[model samples]
Target: MLLNNRIKAFVELGKFLKQFKSTGYEKVNTVLYNDDFFDEMILKINTAEHHNGWFTKENVVFAIEQWADALSEKNLKEWLSSYQLDTIPCKTIGIVMAGNIPLVGFHDFLCVLISGCKVLVKQSSNDDQLLPFLTSYLVSIAPELNESITFTKENFKDFDAIIATGSNNTARYFEYYFGNVPNIIRKNRNSVAILTGTETREELEALGEDIFRYYGLGCRNVSKLMVPQQYNFDSFFEAIYPFNIIINGNKYANNYDYNKAVYLMSNYKLLENGFLMLKEDKSYSSPIATLFYETYTSKETLLTTLEKDEEKIQCIVGNNITPTNIDFGTTQKPKLTDYADGIDIIQFLSKIK
Candidate 1:
């Protein structure tokens, strides 16, 4: 299929997704294949939590809304404008997807197909349902794309390159197995926020979205905070209070209770506001319902530390804190060009031999 054809199909998929959003689902009569897909998609979104407890209906809807906004013709063209998609030689690309959040691995799947390569996907069983259904919708829109997408339960074979996302442990195995091929193997990386004690309450509340979205499971979630020395937590707690309803969910409440109990039993000093816990730590990865924070004496020293540990960080959220800093509340709403771990998948695929 031509690149334009693929873009048109994805735009249709986006339109189909636009019907289902956080506000509500509204069926558009003009959307292609809705008679076959529209109602089933709603069922999947509503019952996603049955497969994975973290896949709440609200979060799943939020994810769909984000993708609906992202796959616009304008956005797709802008993201692909710099790439020579037609010139890239066709090869079968293997994708090992992580199921940390709903549709977390869809970007890699989109890139492989858009670059004119066949994709062999091994989806994490935790998130296996939604993507296949969406891919089916895409295929229904563009029958030619049916040949380009494959989902597998067994080992991948007959692939020229690989893209794998997992923890640090699985990364070692990915490097061992796919080491000879052109591959992008991503490991554990966390996002952090830098506070200068000048952020408005709105910005701080927005930061709560970054922290609490996906229940803090995504690599882009701000799991840690870097605040100025003696920076007070009063404002931060007050701004994030609106999100306290997150604790009402049984799974989240269980995690919060368990973590809090463990901390108290261990005699750890904590700053908590009923639902969320704030701890003083240096680690980038924090547990559920907890946000780790560290105080920095100087901006220069903090930048130096972040630079030194760049590979361990996925995003740095703040206002002009760094050249690449993402604004607050937008970490989960990544653009297509915002490639994970700062590695461009298009450039990598274009050069694959």
Candidate 2:
């Protein structure tokens, strides 16, 4: 039971996007630059600095496809059929975007859209193009939704609810502004890997993609590595040696050169890499240009510790021993079906009723 016009509108958006293939680096910035009036200072960031900042043609097209796939009538019906979203009094929902990674703000948009509410999105300064371009196309495809969407940087007010994603520091600010309001506050987090078994060369190479994609600036990227105490670094290095080309690339190579010199000069305990940082520590997240990895003698103890700290862990990216749906390496892109922090957002909203 859906309106024919709405369905056609969504499908047409998909049709428009299917024609695009994500471009590399500067081309992506050019397209995004053309999309909106972001402040020039933010737009002029070094390419090596904001690796995933560029949303190439393929990325944009995939984003549209992802939106279409998420919004299809059949999928909505199936999702709704699983639970009673009707119990909640849904209305306008505001979302504050996170620009640290590509489309990190999209899940909140999906939440508002799926819950049958008008969406008011405030684009992050670091990300001004994607949403505006996207919504514009959607409006063209289906004029009916023109009323359902709004984008702005206005001081947010007059919203029934909101979702905000920011760094651990900014989350306090978000809480001050929107804490009383019903919302999902997403703070910065990074995924981890639990190594229980040995990995093949193919698997290690795949791990390289997980580490380097978006230049390791994403929450989904494996920012930390866990290996057994006896697991020597030889086989691992051999597997990733082929990716020397990737490590030696412009941005990555610079990160390597800088970090390597800093570690040696400061006498910090860390391994050398032209790109990746192999530090021995028990943490999940890393700085934009850093990696934190540690080894453990006891697998069982590590799993228990991880379970105890599940709040800090977002997703696991690895081979063999990861939990179901945690993701293998090759599928770097997440489908719209994937929920953030594994929370059932619809249920989260309904609980307040």
Candidate 3:
């Protein structure tokens, strides 16, 4: 299929996705193939938690909503505008998806197809439902794509290159196994926030969205904080109080209770609201229901530390703290060009032999 035709198909898919959002689902008769795929989409979104406890209905719908906004014709064109799509060579790309959050690997899937290459996906068993069904919808919109997408459980073979996301250990395995081929192997990375003691209450509240969304499972979620010395926690706690309802989820509550109990038993000092715990630590990756924070005496020292550990960080959220820092609460709402791990998949694919 021509690149424009592929883009049009995804634009249609985005319109179809727009009907299912966090607020509610609204059927749009103009959307193609809704009669056949709409109800099933609802069913999948509703039951996603049964397959993976973390895939709650609200979180799934929110993810869908983000994708709906991202796949617009204007956004897609702008994202791809710099690339010379016609000059790119076509090859079968193997993608090993991580299922920590809903549709986490969809970007890689979209990139391969949009660049006019075939995709072979090995989906994490934890998140295997939604993407395949969506692929069916895309195929209906553009039958030519039927030959371009494939999902598999068996070992990948006959693919020209690989893109894999996993923990540090699995990344090593990927490097060893897919070493001979062109590949983009990703390891564990977490996002953090830098608080200068001058942020508005609104910005702090927005930071709560970054922390609580997806129950803090995504790489983009802020798992840690960098605050100035002796920064007060009272305003921060008050701003984030609205999100305390997250503890009502049994799995989340269980984690909170268990982690809190363990900390208390170990005689660890903690700062906590009723629902969330704050701990003093130097790590970027914090456990569930907890946010690790460290105090920095100077901005220059902190920036040097962040630059030294750049690969371990996915995003740095703050008000102009860094040239590329994301705004508070927008970590989960990544643009198409905000490539993961700061590696551009389009550029990588363009040079595949």
lDDT tens digits by residue: candidate 1, 1-353: 89999999999999999999888889999999899999999999989999999999999999999999999999999999998888899999999999999999999999999888999999998999899999999999999999889899999899999999999999999999999999999999999999999999999999999999999999999999999999999999999999999999888899999999999999999999988999999989999999999999898999998999899999999999899998999999999999999999999998887
What ranges in model 1 sit over 4 Å off? Answer: none
Best by lDDT: 3
Candidate 3: give the clashing pairs: none
Clashes of 1: 0
Candidate 3, poorest ten consecutive residues by summed lDDT: 20-29
TM-score per model over all chains: 0.99, 0.81, 0.99
Off by over 4 Å in 3: none
Predicted structure 3, TM vs. truth? 0.99
Q: Candidate 2 has which clashing residue pairs, if any?
A: 21-57, 21-58, 22-57, 22-58, 23-57
Model 1 per-residue lDDT at 123: 95
Better candidate number, 1 or 3, judged by lDDT: 3
Candidates sorted on lDDT, descending: 3, 1, 2
lDDT of 2 by residue, 108-147 (tens): 7756665556789998876665666566765655566778
User: Candidate 1 lDDT (Cα, whole model)?
Assistant: 0.95
lDDT of 1 at 315: 96
lDDT of 1 at 70: 95
